[model samples]
Target chain A: MQTVIDAHNISKVYNPDTIPVHAVNSVHLHLNRGEFTALVGPSGSGKTTLLNIIGGLDAPTEGQVVINGINISELKPNQLINFRLHNIGFVFQAFNLIPVLTASENVEFIMLLQKRPKAERTRRVHELLASVGLSDKLNVRPSQLSGGQQQRVAVARALASRPQFILADEPTANLDSHSAATLLDIMEKMNREEAITFLFSTHDQRVIDRARRVITLVDGRIENDSAATQIRH
Target chain B: MLLKLAWRNIWRNRNRSLITMSAIASAVLLAVATVSLQQGVWEHLIKNLVSLYTGYAQVHAKGYWDEQTLENSFEIDKTVEQQVAGTPGVNAIAHRLESFALASSGDKTRGCLVVGINPAEEENLTRLSAKIQSGSMLESGQDGALVAEGLAEKLNLALGDTLVLLTQGYYGSTAAMKTPIRGLLHFGSPELNNQIAYIPIQLAQYWLDAPDRATSLVVGLEQAEDLPAVARSLKKSLPKTYEALTWKEMMPEINQHIEADSAGMYIMLGVLYMLISFGIFSTLLMMLAERQREFGMLNALGMQPWSIARVVLAETVFLTLCGSLAGLLLSYPLVWYLAENPIQLGGDMAEIYEKFGFEAIFPATVKAKIFVEQTLVVLSVGLVLAVYPVWRVLRLNAVEAMRN
Candidate 1:
């Protein structure tokens, strides 16, 4: 399998001078294409920080993150933002969809930023929204939609740019059990059918159970890795 | 898409948007009305002062204004008169041979300004016929004089009475005339009413023994704004020994007064602009604060910082333009009404204005230039304030902003 993300010796420290707090301490991880993986941890275990470093949203204090054969840590801020736009998709815990746009426009916004042709963007927007089972909710804004439906729209928006992988931080934390199961089913189906990679940081047991490979983090360190245990040693 | 986004964003908080727009509109309305009234009053003053005696522009020998002696007078011939009359924007020209002289009736002798005028041309240039208090306007080539009412009173003279005028003429020649008073003229200005006397140009020139010579040729203009261009053209077309002078140059105290008033007006306008700037800036600051997370999300979604700034700038442009247009629409009728029906001062205010030789009425002017100028000024203030949002967006830290 092609390696989509390769993060090596990544460390992020907050307030290093006055009171150094190691958010993510010397973590090394790799994500391959089409992989459905979850980074599971208790509270304060640095799952989100590690994900942010790998997604190039925040800079790592110590090491480098390579995505699609380019070292993102060495890129300038503007260049790093561009690189992430082309390679990574992010879903926040709060379902951060632009409230002013309808579901269709929210999904199409990424493609618009990519400067895709109009016909292709239109076709892909329809396909993505339909794939998320939101074909009827295309014209509905986020304020008018339920939390689960808004998250589904956010998922479609994440896939609109055709990114190499998607990083979801607590995607199911804000949903009820039934909504969470439905969202996980949709994500798993997309992973299986479309061969899209997804890396999620979650404390939910359902997400951990559904993920094909689970990496457990304890206090900013990777305590156990299911894929590493099975393949590497 | 940016424009669409900006348009939607403004309406998202409809009240906030309306408030900001109202502020801009109020600024424009106040500015336009204030400036229109100021310009109207100034124009009225200038018209009253210039039309009373000095025409919009005057032509004389090159060095005549500096030395007011009879030796500085120029000969008025058919060619000079035709050349001045043929200039564009030159409506009419009044030839005058002006000098200081002693006027006497019966035992009442007083020093006065003697002006020799072509009765017909002076009528067209200064509307001298309109100011006649009694008797009739002077006829062309009639050997008669028009005495100002105050001067006539002081000299105890009446219509059909002969007044003696004695002065040193051209080249120290004895200039003397005894002309019958055809009319008594009233003037708003006390100085002009007190000492001015007008006689026929032919009789004055013949009495002064300088035939066909005039001390000044006051040129009337079709439009007051054409003064500068007409003066420049007259100067260029006339001989090198002649100069054309606008009324502002002939009477600089009026210009000085206007400039001083404008300085005070500009200081007030500056304060108004500062208030406008703060009003816009505060609204923008609130907008930025409210949309911090959305801006961060957009940045994370791959929209460039400059693109977000463009959207904000576009929003500002729309708000300012709408507000300014609304202000213009609202102010037009008010200005037109005020111009048609001027506000009249009462009691002490009327007396004060009259003491300064001005009418005690305040009118507004409806000028396209005023509207455009005020709108551009408000728009510029708005656009300059918009730079703050662009700067904030460019320096935004997406991670921190998203936390907010």
Candidate 2:
């Protein structure tokens, strides 16, 4: 499989000069195309920090994160944002769909930022919403939708720009069991059918069970890798 | 897309947006109304003062204004008169041969200013006929004099009474006459009312033994704004021995008073603008605080910081534009009403204003320039205040902001 993300010795320290606290420490990881992976840890185990560094949302102080052969760690803030727009997708724990935009508009927004043609954006938005089973909720705003439905819209938005991978940080944390299961089913369907990579940081057992591979983190460092032939220090 | 986002974002907090817009609208209304009234009062004062006697512009011999003697007077030939009449903005020109004289009527003798005027031209230039309190207006080529009401009362002379004027003529000649008072002219200024004595130009020329000589040619303009250009053109077109001056140049005291009053008004306006700035800045701060997470999410989703700033700036522009439009809509009718039905002052205020030769009424002007100027100023203040949000967005950290 083609390696879509390659993170080497990544470390994120909150404050280096005074009262330094290591949020992520010398973490090395790799993710391949079409993989459904879960990064699992207890609270404050640096899972979200590592996910942020990998998703280009936060810069790692010690190492490089190369996504699709470009070292995003070395990119400027604007360039990093551009690279993320064209390459990475994100789903926050709160299902961060724009509150004002409707379901279809929320999904179409990413493609608009990518400067895609209207016809193409419309077609892709319809396809992605249908794939996530939200075809009837096109005009409904996030405030009018259920927690599970908003998350599905977020998923469609993530896939709207045709990025190399999607980064979801505890996406099911705010959902009920049935809604979480439904979301997992849709994500699994997309992962299998479209061959899209998904990397999620979660404390939820359902997500870990559904993920094909699991990586465990403890105290700002990776302690176990289910897919690695040998353990990483 | 950014514009749509900005438009939607502003309406998301409708009450906050409305409050902010209201503040801006109120500021614009107050500013426009205040400036309109100030300008209106000054315009009315100038119109009254100029129309009472002095025209908008004056032409004289180079040293005529400096020296009051008959030797400084100039002769106005037909060519010079035609040239002045043909000037673009010159509405009317009235010639005056002015001198100081002693008026004696039945043992009531007083020092007075003797002004010679062409009846038709003076009527057209200053509407002198409108100021008549008693008797009839002077006819062209008439030999009668128009005495000031106060001067008439001081000399104990009524209309149709004969008044004696005594003065030295040109080249040390004796100038004396006993002319019948044709009218009693009332003036707003006590000084002018107490000292003026008007006679026909031909009669004054004969009395002073200086034929065809005029001390000043008062020029009226079609509009007040044309004063400077008309004065300049007159100066350039006239002979080298003559100079043309605008009313402001001839009456520097009034000009200085207006300048000082304008400076005080500007300081007040500056304070008003500062308050307006704070109002706008507070709104911006609230908007940024409320949308911190959304901005972070947008940054994480691939929108550039400058793009986010542009959206915020667009929001401010829209709010300010809407507010300014509202202000203009509300102020226009109020100003128009005030202009049509001016506010009258009674009692001591009226007395003080009358003492200074100005009316005590307050009015507002409805000029398109005032609307455009106040709107632009409010818009500029809003845009300047928008810098705060833009700067904040530029330095935003997605991780921390999202956490907040």
Candidate 3:
């Protein structure tokens, strides 16, 4: 397994000079390729905050994040955006698919931004949407789809970029129990068969039970890691 | 793809987009109509002043404008007539001899300008026959006169009434004649109505005792815009002893009035544009606020700020185009109708305009450039208002926007 993400001494403080709140304080972690992991914590435990920093959506006040041996924290704003476009996939908590685009169009958007050829973009959009069991919803806009279907389209869009890893911030937060189980099954199958990496933040016990590895956070600090308890491959 | 997305996004909230588009269309319509009407009024003013007396241009003896005496008048020989008649844009030419005279009817007398004109040529240029309120138009070689309505009233004179005209003729000779008023002419111009009296060219020469002599040759063109080129051509073609003057040089007061009036109208139009810009800016601000979370999602999905800005700008461009084109199309029939049937001024407004020698009506122009220039102005206002959305997108904080 390859080491896909490495974080060292990450700290994020809000309003540091006056009545500061440490959102993610001095945390260090690593995620490997093909791993299905969950960052479990109560509310305000900084699980989402840490995930945001690792995904390059927010900057850490201290320390650095490395992805595929590159120091992502050192990149400039424009370069960081390009790097994220190529290397990081994000699944927001709200099923944030663009509402105006059809499922296939939403899935093809990132590839278009990458300037992929028309034939390749079409082929990849079909393949990704079909793999997510959304072949029938290809021409349906997000407004016309259910929450579970929209989330599936979002996952297809995330995979379109062929990023090194995916960071899902509570991907099942808006789904029912049945939908959540189906989504988790799809994600687990992708991890096992395609060897794609997924790191999610959730407080749901069902997600924790299905994860191959779990990291717990308390008060912006990593309390425990399953990797430390098991032998290295 | 981005543009297609933007196109769909605006239609997502159909009511909001339609309302904004209506506001833009209404603004464009009003602004265009206002500008067209103002320009039309100015053009009409110049046309009326020119055709009422001075035609498009005039060919005069070199020193006629400086000195009004009979010595400054010139002989209209065969060469001079042929030279002017062959000029390209010269639609018609009227020979005239103008001089100060005194008219009296039963002890009431007033000083007036006595103008001699070739009836057929003057009718072709100024449509003098149309201004005849009573009796018939003057004819060539007729010894009768056409007295203005106001001057007729001042002298207690009527059609067919004989009036005595007295003036000093060529070489200090006494010139006086009595002639019946063949027609009563009514003019919109106060100055002309109060003092002008027209008679046949032959009679004027016979009375002034200066035969075959005229002070100026008034040349009418096919269109008013051809005045400059035709004036230039005539100035070059005519003999050095004569000078050609366009309406602009002939009536500096009218030119000055048009310039001053247009400046004021432009200021009003500037204020109109500002109001329209603010209306568009308000709508754009609302659009930005409504799409905050969506913009944040896009940014979090690895989309650049400039890309988001481009999408927003594309949406604005689409809206402006739809609104502006519709407004322009709607304005066509309205402008055309108003141009053909001008709105009449009523009550004191008519009196005020008549007092200044202007017609009492508001007319619109159907010129192509008026529509084109107005569309560009409104589109520019839309573009200027787009800056708000672009700025908001460029500086958007993904986390904050998503949270909101």
Model number with the top TM-score: 2
Candidate 3: the clashing residue pairs are none
Query: Ten residues in a row with the worst lDDT in model 1 chain A?
Result: A224-233
* Tens digit of per-residue lDDT, candidate 1, span A123-190: 99999999989999999999999888899999999999889999999999999988888899899999
Give the candidate order by descending DockQ: 2, 3, 1
Measured by DockQ, the strongest candidate is 2
lDDT of 1 by residue, B21-93 (tens): 8888888888888888888888877776786578888889888988988899998867888999999999999
TM-score between model 3 and native = 0.87
Q: Tell me the tens digit of each residue's lDDT in model 2 across B70-165.
A: 899998778888898889999999999999999999988999999999999999898899889989888867889999998999999999999999
Q: Determine the backbone clash count of candidate 3.
A: 0
lDDT at position A49, candidate 3: 87
Q: Would you give me the overall lDDT of model 3?
A: 0.87
Q: What is the lDDT of residue B115 in candidate 3?
A: 95
**B227: Cα error in model 1, Å:** 3.7
Q: After superposition, how far is residue A20 of candidate 1 from its true place, in Å?
A: 2.2
| Colliding pairs, model 1 | none
What CAPRI class is candidate 3? Answer: medium
Evaluate residue B235 in candidate 2 and report its C-alpha lDDT on the 0 to 100 scale.
83
Q: Each prediction's Cα RMSD?
A: 3.4, 2.8, 3.8
